[model samples]
Target: MDPLTIGILGFCALFVLLFIRMPVGTSMMLVGAVGIYMIRPQASLPVLAGEIFGEASNYSLTILPLFILMGNLAGVSGMSRDLYNAAHSWFGHLKGGLASATIVGCAGFSSLSGSSLAAALTMGRVSLPEMQRFGYDNGLATGAIAAGGTLGILIPPSAGFVVYAILTEESIGRLFMAGVVPGVLLTALFITAIWLIVRRKPEKAPQSVTAEPVSKRMASLGRAFWIIGIIVLTIGGIYTGVFSAVEAAGVGAFLALIVTVIRGAASWENIRDVSLQTLKSTGTVFLILFGAFVFKTFVGFTGIPFRLTGWVEAQGFGPTAVVITILVAYIVLGTFLEGFAILVLTVPLVQPILQSLGVDLVWFGVLIVIVLEMALISPPVGINVFVVKGIADNVPLNTIFRGIWPFWFAMLLAAVLILVFPQIALLLPNTMFG
Candidate 1:
């Protein structure tokens, strides 16, 4: 078969396997290996042959496990609970205050953990019961957690950004820096969404009587200072060129460990649990990466990316139109695929087109992650929704799905902001890198 035909067929088969519930990593690897053997066996086998071990031993990839460990350590040590308690003290007086506080907590935790599901699950445990106690509607309560959880991938130290950088050969530091402003902006947007919901339906989110004394509030805030300082030490170091991404991961993990120990939350069992969880999370991510690398190379050999880029350019749709189309497709695709899976599968086809248009890869990356953020809360295959449902099982699946729509729209608005002001995603990266 012709290379184009092989690429088309292979792509379709990969999707079919995914629909049939094949692990995305396994499906991609299978299709890639099969495509290569059928197309031209000689050149591509070496790439697939070493993908498993090569990515495993990759030095730069060390940042992933280190960052995951930091998050897991912080989680096991109750740092996440402290952060939520702090947000609650300050925001618990407003209608929907607890839900808003949950969003704030998720954002802060995202800074530390950089995993959306972790942020959601941790905050859900900490905040959900509190919100329920305050008579907050289940939909509003769960929506905030599910939506806030998406912040994990847009914030610095994001595993999604790490994967994008590795795939696009973009600088990880620049990508991390690019995420800072957008992450905060989206968090603010989520808070606004909660406020709007409660403002319109006052009974849905009752005001918490948590009007704690100023001194008490200040003390609570003080407890959160070290967490802020940790962000500065890790993400801030990357922004100022004081540390490489991998080094920043190390510094963050080490500091997280210290904080856990200092808080007297340390235990041999906690350490063991953190280590074991980190190992599991890191292994899942690495396997997908291995398979993605294999699939990307297979597609590259077929010349599909170049041909697709050439055809799009030849169509006179212009760069903006092409970009808008891709974004829309991603928004739709997210409903069916996990965020990371959509990313790995589509970038092979889309990155070349964006590059050909002279679009900045770093900015495009931020936009992609933002869209993926929406994907996490999207209907049908929204993984974070399912994650939160598992935690808040009393909430109906459709209700959980319904709850995310407002935040999903907020994320969509954030994407538009990034589009209109590309600087939202690029300013830090440019100021730092330039």
Candidate 2:
């Protein structure tokens, strides 16, 4: 068979392996190794060894563990509750206000953590019971937390953006700045989705206790200062060039450490748990990253990216059609593959097409992250839904899936808006850095 045929079959086989409960990193690496051996057995062993050790030592990746440490450390600290309470104080009286507060809390926590799974797990634990106590509809209640967790990837300090930056060779700071505006827009869109649902269904989101006195509200706001301060300093420092993404990660981790200690969660056991969790999460990411590099190397040898792009260009599709087709493919893939895997597998094929079309790589990166955000909430493989399910076990899996529908479509609308007005994803990066 020709190289492209082998590559195609290898791709399908990787998915099959994954479906049979294989680890993503192992699956990708196995297929890549076997494929490379088929083509060049003499070179395969050295290449695989180089990818494993070389990827571990890659300097660009130093930021990953630092960021993960900050998130895991901050997650254990009491900010999730503080953030939720702060948002609850301000918006709790509005229709769907508690649910809205949950989104706000998720957004704030995501900035601190840079992780969707951590955000979903933390916020689900913090907010679900409160929403349930408020007599909110189960679908609306679980759905809001599930959907809100998606922000973890779209907000600044996002691991997804960091990985994308590494893959695309873009400036991590600019990619991060690019995420800010769209992150805000999507947060608004999600809140709006909650509003429409409440407005139409009426009983889905009953009025919250918006009647708190000003003093009580101020107290709640005061409680969230740690979240606000960490976000502004790290993200703001990145925009102004006071810190590179790596530096920001280090500083964020240090500050989070200080806060954890100051809050007296500094017990050795707590620190150990946080550190262990950080190590595990970091290991998973890097393992997958290693596999991606090896697999991408193998794929590169196949010339599939070039052939695929050539064939698509030959068909003479309009720029808009090509873009739409790529996005539609992401949506479909989102239902089955995890977002990072989808990104790793497709970027090699898609990047050249995008570069050829004269698309802005930074803007496209932001768009990709946004779609991945939707993927986290998309049914079936909606990873965030599973995260929430692990915490809110009494809620049926289907109900959580049903609840996320509005937020999923809202994310789609947000993606459309960004495409129509590229500046939504570009404005901050362009103005702040360029």
Candidate lDDT scores, in order, read: 0.90, 0.87
Summarize candidate 1's per-residue lDDT along 35-85 as a digit string, tens digits. 987787885678787887788788888999999888887788777888898
lDDT of 1: 0.90
The runs of at least 3 residues in candidate 1 whose Cα sits more than 4 Å from the true structure, single-residue gaps closed, are none
Task: Report the C-alpha lDDT of model 2 over 1-434, residue by residue, as the tens digit.
Answer: 67888899889898899899788888889999998888778878988999899889888788888887887777778867888899999899998999999999899988978888988888889888988988899999999998898898889788998888877888888988999999899899999999999999989877767578999999998988887788899998988889988899899999989988889888999999998999999999998888887888889877888887788789887666877788889999999888988888888788888887778889988879888888888878889999998988899999999999999999999999998999999999999877
Query: Which model scores highest in TM-score?
Result: 1
TM-score of each: 0.98, 0.97
Give Cα distance to truth, residue 424, candidate 2, Å. 0.4
Candidate 2 lDDT (Cα, whole model)?
0.87
